[model samples]
Target: MSLIITDECINCDVCEPECPNGAIYQGDEIYEIDPNKCTECVGHFDEPQCQQVCPVDCIPLDPNNVETKEQLMEKFVKLTAKS
Candidate 1:
């Protein structure tokens, strides 16, 4: 599943740089995760890097954008190809 940044985000700018897919961005209010670009760091790390660094623990799996691990890997491959 992809990750989502809730209203709890502090906009501390820590999570933005930790996202390997660059899915996290400065939204109008809080940091937003673009599901299209979010692989949950499957291609790059063992766990979601943003979640690890976020102080408020606002990052969570996006149930609305859920995907299987295999599906996430496929998306990661596609994203890697674009680079």
Candidate 2:
């Protein structure tokens, strides 16, 4: 599943840099995760890097954008191809 940054985010500016997929961005009130670009770091790391660095633990799995591991890998490949 992709991740989502909740209102609990402290805007510490830490998670943005940690996201390998560049899915995290500054929203009007908090950091937002773009589900389209999020791969949960499947191609880059065993775990989601954003979740690792967020101090407030505001980033969580997006139930609304859930995907399997294979699907996430496909997304990672597509994103890498664009880069």
Candidate 3:
């Protein structure tokens, strides 16, 4: 599943740099995760890097964009090829 940054985000700007996919961005109010670009760090790390660095623990799996590990890996491959 992709991750979502909730309103609990403190806007500390830590998670943005930690995201390997560059999915995290500063929204109008809080950091937002673009599901299209989020691969849960599948090709980069074992765990979501943003979640690990978010001080407020606002990052959580996005149920709306749920996907299996294989799907995430596929996404990672596709994204990497574009880079």
Leading candidate by lDDT = 1
Put down candidate 1 lDDT per residue, 1-83, tens digits, no spaces: 89999988889999999988889899999999999999989979999999999999999999999899999999999998955
Q: Candidate 2: lDDT over CA atoms?
A: 0.92
Please provide TM-scores, in order, for all candidate models, with all chains considered together. 0.96, 0.95, 0.95
How does model 3 fare in lDDT? 0.91
Can you give the lDDT of residue 19 in candidate 2?
Answer: 86
Could you tell me the lDDT of residue 20 within candidate 3?
A: 87
lDDT, candidate 2, 1-83, per-residue tens? 89899889999999999888889899998989999999999999999999898888888899899899999999999999955
Q: lDDT at 82 for candidate 1?
A: 50
Evaluation by lDDT, superior candidate among 1 and 3: 1
> How many angstroms is residue 43 displaced in model 3 relative to the true structure, after the best TM-score fit?
0.9
